[model samples]
Target: MSSALPPASSGQPPVAASPLQPVTAGILTALVGFGSTFAVVLQGLAAVGASPAQAASGLMAVCLAMGVLGLGLSLALRMPISVAWSTPGAALMAATGAVQGGFAAATGAFILAGGLIALAGFWKPLGRMAAAIPPALASAMLAGVLLKLCLSPFTAVAVAPVPALAVIVTFLVVGRFFRLWAVPAAVAVAIGLTLAGPGSAGFDTAALALPKPVFVMPAFTLEAAVGLALPLFLVTMASQNIPGLAVLSAFGFRPAAGPLFRATGLGSMVIAPFGGVTVNLAAITAALAAGPDADPEPARRWIAGVTAGVAYLGLGLLALAAAAGFGASPPLLIQAAAGLALIGAFGASIAGALKEEADRPAALVTFLFTASGLSVAGIGPAFWGLVAGVAVMTLHGRLGRLTHP
Candidate 1:
């Protein structure tokens, strides 16, 4: 943070911005070239009804798009604020789809959810309140919220030894050895394993073909709106966006909530037509792209995020690639890998909720309700849990005020 650029006569020092070197910024973009958008593209297709072919097309499309976008955006913003399709958002799509309607209906629901986020982002007080949320509780809630995703790999590994063991071990070892690029290292291993299938031929290319959206016009029944829209909105905001902002800030970058929301919203809106319904700021991926390790200098890492965003935009374009490559994944592997990733997030969230002596009770209430796995008329348990916790605390605070005052 040197001010050498400012002349003495100016009396104010010029802010010494970070340099945009290839290793500093470009390396991060390359790491996420597949590590991020690719994983998400897989998860997303699985959520919708995309077959193996559709998945590949979608994967190829999204990957190239995301990479190009990441490069351009990172360079443009000179900030490392990255964005990706929300993994949780995709999970929500899958979960809700299981309980409800078709992909088009889900896309409608997805856009509705994004609008709500846009609303939240635009409101000054809401943004501040979201920001003011006790950092620890925010973190704890995030950890608690994501715990399930991190543990999913065990089930996969238990059933299929070769692939699961290969992915998990590589990720761990590479992560341990090459701290900056461990996840990518692991992903490369997974790709290699996929290519060199246990005994048979790997990656059947005929399956990797162009993906055209099977246009299922949405029929928005009250059931669809109630069951789907409400829950998607809640999880994307509470479980994902809230923590995303915090992560960005923690890494010394400002959370540009408005642009972040609008851009994701717009992206979701864009691909909504082609069976690519939902997209949002990626939480774990954001953590990966925004961390100080993404670049040596805290300030320079903003370019990393920008790089990720650009990558996402690219992913949006290659519908065929996305379709072709999105479905070769083992369900159990996805569940395990995602579950394991979220374990720490879940723990930290619960810890944050209860970290303060005064907030311990509230945290407990939140944890229990969230863990209850209840769905009220289709809304996830989180909304209800938040309400119950906040309501009880408000009541308690009011009663105490009457007695003391």
Candidate 2:
């Protein structure tokens, strides 16, 4: 009897057929990207004073923005350029909590951040300013912002042991076997636990209602612009856009960064009224669409990028369901899921922050100050953290020069 199996399937890992390869990779990219950090987005919006409806709208809007922009960029550039919501920015918002003017003011800050991002794309000085920020300080700030949420898993265990442990255990086991699926698996377990609880019947009804945009007129305040907008733009640039470009470079797809930044920044501005905070190039998930796994030939990998965009659009349709499910769960439980998702990022940030012994003192100051939750003169810890680090570095530099001279 003759077998119809492809030769590779007999022993080696089964290779997807050429046409299906990009599609499969794209779908996986969307699933991993969306499933991993969406809770962080919703939590961030809520912390920044968004009502449940507004938070859901923000989620839906960002999904759509990334979907549209990712597709456009990929098709135009013919490179696997994936887009994503800024996970670090979301965490920063969560850490910052509600500003003076509430969600409306936060919306204004989002607009400001969007404008800055767009400017960075076109204005050389603005882009150079962001690049001038020390890598150690930036990473330290990110790690500090993530510290609170990353502790949620443990705190959650104290609050609700059974569900928290279940999520953590699933995360560890799945991570050991299939690393990319780990966070999603933990999310699934948490959702199951949440919906299985009493009073979860309301989620079914809530899920049926489609997501709708909730427009908030922008109301800018000095506090919000300094505290929320600046930090958000810096974090998005350092953590998302820069790394995203590097990922593309690693894959040998060298599309100009300026156009991509402008696209995502403009997309963010368009969606801000609808409650979307920010969107940018995908860093971690870019690998899924740009890597060799997407296709044997680099030239054809844009198909995966395009497919990922379509998948994001489809995911946007389910925003209401996702919001409802997370909303139905206990805040800590949902936070635990979000925390687990951020572990890898936190680890990376910590490693980067501490890599250079020369810069370690400044990085340490940034991390501690940012993690202290300090708010002076209505500015957030993030801004202060950066300031403190810069001050320390400058003073250290002057002292060293004086001594040497």
Q: Return the TM-score for each candidate structure.
A: 0.71, 0.93
Per-candidate total of colliding backbone pairs: 68, 0
Judged by whole-model lDDT over C-alpha atoms, candidate 1 comes out at 0.53
Candidate 2 segments exceeding 4 Å error: 1-17, 198-202, 398-405
- In terms of TM-score, how similar is model 2 to the real structure? 0.93
- Give one digit per residue, the lDDT tens place, for model 2 in 81-124: 89999999999999999999999999999989998999999887
In model 1, what is the error at residue 43, expressed in angstroms? 3.3
Provide the RMSD of all predictions against the true structure, rounded to 1 decimal: 5.9, 5.2
Worst 10 residues of 2 by lDDT: 1-10
Cα-based lDDT at residue 245, candidate 1: 71
lDDT (Cα, tens digit) per residue for candidate 1, span 1-405: 322122344677555545654244444554454453355445545665555544554444444434543455456556565555555555544433333455555556655666666666676665554444434333433443454445555666777888888778866786687754555555555555554554535556664343444443544544546555664555566556667677666666664677666655555555544444444455555666666445555556656666555545444454454333323443454444445444444565666666676666666666566555667775555555666666655655732442234
Structure candidate 2, residue pairs in collision: none
